[model samples]
Target chain A: MSSHQAVREGAKQVVRLLEKFPEEKFKYLVSFKATQLERFSRIAGIPLPKKLATEVPGENKTSINEIKDIVNRTSGPLGLQKDMLRKMQAAIPHDQFTESAMKDQITALSNLVNNKYKNYYDVGDKLYKPAGNPEYYQRIIDDIQGKKKENILAGLRTVFMGR
Target chain B: MLKCTARKSSLNTVTKLYGINAAKTYNYNPVSLYSTTNKNLQADQKKQTELEFDTHGSPIVRGQKSTIPEYKLPKWKEALGEYVIKTFGLDMDKIRAGPVAGSYYYSICKEQGLQYENEPLSDSAKFFYEDLKLPKTFSQWFQITALHEWMLFVRMRAMPFKYGRNYQQKLVDKTFSDIEMRLFDEMNIHSGRIVDQYSKDFNSQLKGAVFAYDVGFYTDDTTLATAVWRNLFGGRKNIDYTHLDAVVKYIRSQLYVMSRMSDREFALGKFKFVPTKEKINKLSAQEEEEMKQKIIKKYEELDKSGLLLPSDKSNLSYDN
Candidate 1:
């Protein structure tokens, strides 16, 4: 086969391999670093592709920076801290413990109990019912808020409290 | 109306649609006929008013300008005109999409970077110029505007090929027209040759930037950011990483929203840029489904009402 045809055939093989990849095997690949993979290939005495070693600057950094910058910019108008603004990315699995989920819960809970505070006692009305434990929800909220507050203070402390 | 029929029948033998009895129709000019009748009427009135002769002349009217009567075709003729145009298989939707995609879309893109002397910047203009810290020069404005035009072109390419090509042509035509006008008025470049040179330079830059952006869009964010840095930021060394990141995010969000838009909605010029200040969260699958249903219902209702003209109708999907 020609080189072009060989490349196409190689690509088709890789796609077939990916389709057969198990979740457990994929999990290992997720945790596998490039250095580890290189070490494995060396031990196996197989040469690796040149492109495998190519490091594109800001390739992986852009997504994190994009999310961080967007959260930071949006926080200013929403009267929230940068860490508290969860974007609730639709591309990912919904985690109720995420910042965005907490914010939604607080808003919904606040409306149901008709109190401004997003806590357990305010939700003691007849209309409100705790699915499992009321304090459980409260603890999650408190923990997230406490951690976020400490983060903000630490950020501030570094600026005000010099090394 | 009779005068129109008379003129058409007398002027052309092929105008059988006007009337069957061409010889019976008066061949005189209506203006001259009306003037003679008016003169006769004035003479008779003068004779009647001779008994009440007064010293005061005709009253002078102030502020009221003379109004000319406008001719309008009858409903049947108007419908017939559309019917004839349609029977020839002219693409009406493509013609209508021109103004919406070209003039309307270009205005949206232009306003993003538009600045006036001795005036406050608009919200988007402030975002690009002040917040992003780009220079406020005319060339800089063109860069910002061209970037936005490129984003719209990405969505325009998703449209059916023929209509999309026409839309692209109209938009480029409008871009050049506005640039020429600005050169004369805003830049005060009175010489034709100098304006031509500047336009040629901008045209070449636009072509290059478009190709680069297309490459970036198809590849990855890194390439896209590099393109933005080179074209929009002029490859300056003092560029802020945060600004670059924000612009990339902005472009991605705008593209995401546009990718979700149906062809009919986009063709009708319903797409608006997501403001920099607002966050566009990804719509849940349920929300997207609901949105699709709403779009389908809206178009169905409009179609059922039969309010849209032949020129306004489109074959593009509203539910996609």
Candidate 2:
């Protein structure tokens, strides 16, 4: 229920209580409740939201698939902590299903999924160098240099094929 | 209506009428139309020798040497003994095509007395295809085949002149014959038309091999990587460089390993490709030497069995 609707209902209950009890003793409790609700309405700098929860959009299962798809495309660049939903799904306990725990799991999965993408954003669209064998590279250099001076030069002793 | 009043004058009549002014000068300029190709040197013989060498063998000089090796080959009778040729030992056109083409007919015949071909010679190498995990895809499969062919080419190049040519010819001949067979049997193509296709493929492959050799043999790993990525990997521009690096390493390791094999081993087709996983570049010198020693020992055992031919190990001075 919305905050306004709940407040209206609570006020009706207080009115009913006042009518039944006919006592000043419970007035302070009612006033204290009003003060608490007022305090909650204003937080640090921003006003606290009393917006009612609409149907929490979609199911986590389909969202999980979408999350996986994003992870596959972006996670290649991230190069770590992959198979997010698969791992999370595997880790979820079958014995118990708690809303808060499920929500926490979702938060953790989202964090894992989003972090790589954010890291990708930080990386920008720059080209990445692949892993290579340094020794092999060196050997290739050595081979070519040797060939250049000896084989190529020797072949070109009589004829000059421009290097 | 137009009438033909103008008489057609012959050259003499025109010249007679116009006198010396109308006469065309017949003075021949001293410049020769054809330039002397060889000039003073007897380069025809040298060219012939080089052609002969190229015809019968892979024209690979030692890594250190630049001089062209002379055209030396096995006796025509010995090399072509089994083939049913009646007249000439070797044809001029065949010789001109180079050793690879000239040896094409003889190379197809299975080596009769060899351990693997005949009754077991006891020293035949047991290289299983499964160990290498050769790629199953057509492009990759061909790449692996190309790798094997290229390896043989390297060995052929490194080989002492006489045997190198023979081996090169045999390998190429086998390749062509195999292609011919594939076309005829598998592809349902007629035998008569196989050679046209074979020649096309053979020339194309040789061209590709030359590039791969230059890139893989002499250049840096990145170049080798690029070459492999182009030829072996189908030039996929989006391919990961790390994968290219891996391919470069694979090529480097193969070249190194192939360089170590004795000509006998290569001739026998006994060299086992280093598995893709075993990075040869990672091995220590001592470890590599130890491995070489083990290979040497295996060959020694084969040598004892009298299977190895004694290739000339001495250097011969040839005037360039």
Candidate 3:
């Protein structure tokens, strides 16, 4: 299947899993998925889906489903999807999620994902995020391409393990 | 301006026969009388008879020796006594016995270039006259008068006379003739009592005596009379007379002390001075920093307590 088609299918499966989880586990699922997508986006050199960007201000600007599909197609064999599903299932019983904690986690995860994408641009495009300046999409794409082989491997691992 | 006239006396014929001019009778010339033949002959006879006859007289001289007689030195005590008696018409004995005699004699000896013989009165007179350069009687009188006048002047100047009201303004406004008359009147009042008390026989001589007394009291040569005048009249003229008197007395006393001390070389004397070193301890950099920290801690505590006002915060801020 095409990369876009595979990304859409993976997004549908994630939505089904989220609906089945208790409300308290929703934050864990979102954070785990956001983290996994961030890894995928850095490796692929693509903007995050728009739905994910709406969920967090600094995430990739792509639809949520699109980001999920991209992660599933590119990162499924690496096992990030299975790992996040399992963590969500485990967190549901312990009251392991709280609104404030979830916000903190989301913010932290967003920053980490943004930094990873910024790093990709820094290496590949010779497009340094000058000490204080912001990173751009084209520079990120070029950066990811320059390190395409290693990032793809890492991306596969992040998808499978949800690191 | 008193004039005296005297009647001339006519000489008798016997007097004319003696070659005396009758018209000019009173102050007759004795030498002129001797020049007349009759008188000349009598004088010659008297001189020849008085002289001792010398058998081997070398070239007989007819008249007294041509050489002038050695000046007969007058005895100072006698001459001065006579002068005092005649000049002041006072008893010589009284003055000679008085405290001023030494100064009087000293003046005479100085004038004549004579040395004193340790006579107390003569020496004292000489000392006072030469050193102070004032006549004995005059110096004594001057000392008293000067003290009186200085006291009066100081008191008068000191008398807190306000600018518009005092005699000074009046002096400025009045015409010379009017001022003179006013001055005469003031002088009459001012000196009248003094004259009455000191000497009722106030003549030129008495005035001279009073002047001498005044001068004697104020004769400090260092600042001189001009400075005295300036001190007396300069600046605010309306100061309290009593205060001015006290100030003058203080200044005079200070001046006297200064004058006396100025003649001595204190530095070379036993009172030589030395300076001592002073020990100074200063704060080190560490101490300064510690002090700053302590102050900062105090301010922080104050701020935390909310005790500091807005003004305090504004002052505390670095940006301010």
Candidate achieving the largest TM-score: 1
TM-score of chain B of 2: 0.47
* lDDT per residue as tens, model 3, B2-70: 111222223221221111332354344446545655875555544322312221221111121321123
Q: Model 1 over residues A128-154: C-alpha lDDT tens digits?
A: 112212222233234433542435665
For every candidate, the chain B TM-score is 0.73, 0.47, 0.16
Order the numbered candidates by TM-score, best leading. Answer: 1, 2, 3
Least accurate stretch of 10 residues (summed lDDT) in model 1 chain A? A120-129
Docking class of 1: incorrect
Compute fnat per model. 0.00, 0.00, 0.00
- Cα lDDT of model 2 by residue, B1-320, tens digit: 11111111222221111223321432222233234664533433332222111111222222212212354445775445424332333432223224332232223221111111222321111211222222223234335455556655554544444555555566666556555554565455676755576657655865675555454344333334445545655543223323444445455556556555554454444455565555454456698578667766765566467643222111211110
DockQ of each candidate, alpha-carbon based = 0.01, 0.01, 0.00
lDDT of each: 0.58, 0.39, 0.32
The prediction achieving the highest lDDT against the true structure is: 1
State which candidate, 2 or 3, has the greater lDDT: 2
**Per model, how many backbone clashes are there?**
0, 4, 31
Whole-model lDDT, model 2: 0.39
